[model samples]
Target: MLVSLEIERVEPLADGAPFGAVGAYERVVGKAKGEVDPAAPGNRGIALIDKAPRNASGKVEYTTDIFILRPKDFSRGNGRILYEVNNRGRKMLFGYIADGPQGVNDPKTMADVGNGFPLRQGYTIVWSGWDPDAPRANMGLGLTAPVATDSGRPIVQKVRDEFVSGTRGGALETFKLSCEAASLEQPRARLTMRERAGDEPRELPLNQWSFVDARSIKLRDGSKPRPGWIYEFHYEATNPKVLGLGFAATRDVVSWLRYDAAALAVTGGPISHALAIGFSQAGRYLRNHISEGFNRDEQGRKVFDGIHSHIAGVGRIFFNTPFGQPARTGTQHEDHFFPENAFPFSTAMQSDPLTGKSGSLFRGDGSDPKLIETNTSTEYWQKGASLLHTDPLGTTDVTLPDHSRVYMIAGTQHGGRAGATTDAGPNVNPRNPHNPMPAVRALLMALDAWVVSGQAPPASRVPTLADGTLVEADRTGFPAVPGAAVVKVTNQVAPPGDWVNPTPPAKAYRTLVCKVDADGNEAAGIRLPDIAVPLATYTGWNEYKPPYPAGELADRDGSCLPFAVDAAARQAAGDPRPAIAERYKSGADYQARVEAVVASLLADRLLLPEDAERYRERAAKEPRVAP
Candidate 1:
């Protein structure tokens, strides 16, 4: 039977003594010559050294002059000596003695230098071997003391005790025996910082950092005198708004080596130095401070054009969003995804006549009016183009002609929900309900394989409709909306009577109106509208028209009197119901709202009818799951 074997010194022999040394000669004699004497009782299987006694050295030592003798007996029924005893024992003994000094004595000297047999100080030699047939046999013969201090303890402990430590026996030994033994050389690390010609002021907090090295490496043949291993270090400022974050890279060292004549020790290598510079800035700066565009001469022109030009062919572009942008349909909101902006406002407001107004009154009409209808031909769309143009930033013109991979993680909050971002507060989403990290990792692995093996990645890892399960890479683009369910209303609007001023003096007025499907189902694709009521007195009103004049009875002076329901007002309406008594009942209101919006979109041809119908059916049968 084949078996495995392992051996270790559970309890090291004391007094620096070697293991199995005492019985070495006795075993050798037993194996070479079966028995020393046949007439002696109980000595049939015994060897000569078994009867030897310890000398003054307190240990058994085989004498160099010891020899083996074979008996001569008569043959062929005649008592005659077969042959005179030959002097072969002395001749064999001579060869053993001649080889002993070099083999045995030299090994003993090396052992003493390495700290008596496999251990010295606190360092112990550890090794492993296997013999298929003799599983239980000794397999611990290959262990040796560390190359550096064959007689000393680990350097780390020595350093802790206020003594200088050497790397010769630790990392160097392990590196040489493992990595270097295969003829692999450690690649020199290189760092390239993106900066302009002049010095730029920046600061990088060491605490918030990530070090990314080659996950797997392949060396190129005939590349250079010293080929470098590619690595990337990504560091984001804890304060997300702080731009111009800088970074510095250097080799990680344990302790410094000192040169001293008394010790006569050779230092391992020179300490690695660093290149420090800033890659980003809090605000935009020109390529040259004194360049043509220095004096605010190009305020209306694109701010990112120069930066994009400078970084054209340097390296791959990385898109980083410290705080995720609010979910929107198109790229109009992309520029606001960066940290420079504190809050999101519609681009239409940029050209508002009263643009300088404070508080929430900065946008739209001054009346805090909802559903204010305005023509799209105004400057609103133009402002959107300007703001949106800044989004691609330095990467606007960059084309990955090499077919470099692009990984877009769906349903992920910016900068990770828990990392170094201003949004990392307790109230933030604890976990991304839609897990996308797994998918991102799979994509990265695929890219790695593609780059290394010349294998093209699959057109899509996403599952077909017939496939039964979702894989990591399958969840690539966007998260599927959760099943439609009840929506919970945390905030409620007051009824007309409860309002500071009631219109038409009605007993029960509909303060909030929620439009549902003709079937009155609260599933997906149900529509909602603003609160509609009979006017106390109508000056003039039209469903498709706006800016209708209020009649004489309109309470224009009071806070709640001049209120009129409009399209914008319907879209911005808040929930007007109390919390459910049970926790499960809370999501009812939101479910109703989402269904209503989806229904409207379908009606307006914004969504495909088939898609709308499917979602509606799903929402009706089961609750919508949140992405």
Candidate 2:
């Protein structure tokens, strides 16, 4: 396990800038080499591990990219490690949690680290590659894994690929396949197109497209791919990497750092506790890691003491199968039928009536870590988030274990961007830009305390059917706003299906959503100031434009529909909601209301003091009502 770590480069972070009392920090960039025993108890569950090529010692070898930032003087810093799972090989913890700049994969300057929140808190930030197919653009991190073979011979299998073009993608002439084609002449290959997920797929003539090479396909000159249309391809492929080794590699890396004193040479100090945080696609990886029992190292020691999964909803990653594409995920208007949504959605043990399977995310052993699951409103509408708290049949709420806490950050989109105003992409309405980072920052600190000192964090903040806040998707009680469409359809959850050759589900599982007030805002959840105080009617669902399917939910987008400026404007528009002027006497009145809500949130430990001040400053600048 973690046999060697080769340091490639080391440099002072931000040109030796001091971050509070922790002093200057150093960034270590290197490659981590590890080997796993297929016959070992902890590694046996990894798919295709036995089929992978082995070293001289009969152990499977793997190499992964590693990046870490730690205090130069380890004794003065917190003795904890904060590991952030990168999304698509790119890091986002700084931007999402520290209010830092977005899309900086390689950070060097002060601006790159944003406000340096993690450094000031004396955290040893760590990142490692876990996906073999992760993109290498922009210095993206990834693992180099061995392909599964049978007795020195290649293994071939049929794989399926799904692709959906964007609004401006109609001019696109070529699409890349996830796996290489076995031969140039593919007689068994079939290409089908569908208008929507429920519609029947129409087979396209073979003459319409031709294989550009073993790895990509190009459409004929006359045939242009339509936007928002689903395209499916089936072909024979070979050379499937042992992707499941990613789990073992992650476990081994963390285990070596915690139990091995030699790790201090890399970590800059001894790490007593390790916390893992993942966002979006990476978040789903954590669920799979826990469910697959990777938390227990080979030596029976815990790898991570705490886990924070954000925006993953009730799904696990499709990463442990043959020819698996870890980058693909199921969404409403795209990637509709993947193996992400499986049984045992909740943390507590439960039974799936369809498959007759009874289990939970936890292995029921003592290897479970303290879990903090955070989701945005978009997950409830597009990702089957209700199943995380409700039973499989959507009948009643399931109580979470003492070690787990779930919170729903309302009125935000999946990519919680702050200060979003204009409509972008194919959506008809303005996209939701309400930042949920303030709550995220606070919860991260709370999770660290719980793991370090055995202190319980805040109580779970989620809507429940017992309180009448969670109901059927159609019963959200939305107001009839002009030029706005209400959401009645959500992502369907069905029984697990075969990944390579999947068939249609005979029946579907019931899904629910969060109830909303008359103003079309979510009534229950961790309501930020933008939601607690009225500024606009924010919703987790947004409709696609005309070119796309009608009434279908846009992929992971939310809407922000502002209220009328005055009563006259509201009456003229036939809007039932109160006007801004009628709700507040003046601009100052609105700011006061926002301030009060922020103070309450701070007292509840749902917001940090720095974020509270940011909210006040933003509220004072936005004066929708007359002074």
Per-residue lDDT tens digits for candidate 2, residues 1-627, read 899988899899999999999999999999999999999998988888989999999999999999999898898789899998888899988888877888899988898888888889999998999999888677688999999988779888988898878732344567888887887785678888998877888888888888999888877876778878888898998888999999988898888888898898999878999999999998999999899999999989899999999999987887888888888878777777788989888898888888899988888788899999999998988888888888888898998889999999988888785545557567778778788888988898889989999889988888889999988888988899998867788888888777666777887777788899889899998999888987788888888886777677888888888899888999999999999888888778888998999989998889989889988998788757677
Off by more than 4 A, model 2: 167-173, 419-421
TM-score of each: 0.17, 0.97
Considering every candidate listed, which one attains the maximal TM-score? 2
Question: What do the candidate models score in CA lDDT, each in turn?
Answer: 0.18, 0.86
lDDT of 2 at 130: 92
Tens-digit lDDT track of model 1 for 1-627: 001111111221233243322211100010000111223222212122222233454322211111111111101111100000001111111111111111121122222222121111111111111100111212111111011111233111100000000100111110001001111122222112111111221322332221222222222332221111111212111111100000000000001111112111111122111111101110011111111121111112111111111101111111012211111111111111112211111112222122232221112222111110110100111111111111111112111212222222212221111111221111111221221222322232233334335454333211112232211111222111122112111011111121111122222101111112211111111111111111111110001001111111110000011111332432344322211221123245434644675566445433344344544554445432221
Error of 2 at 282 (Å): 0.6
By lDDT, who's the top model here? 2
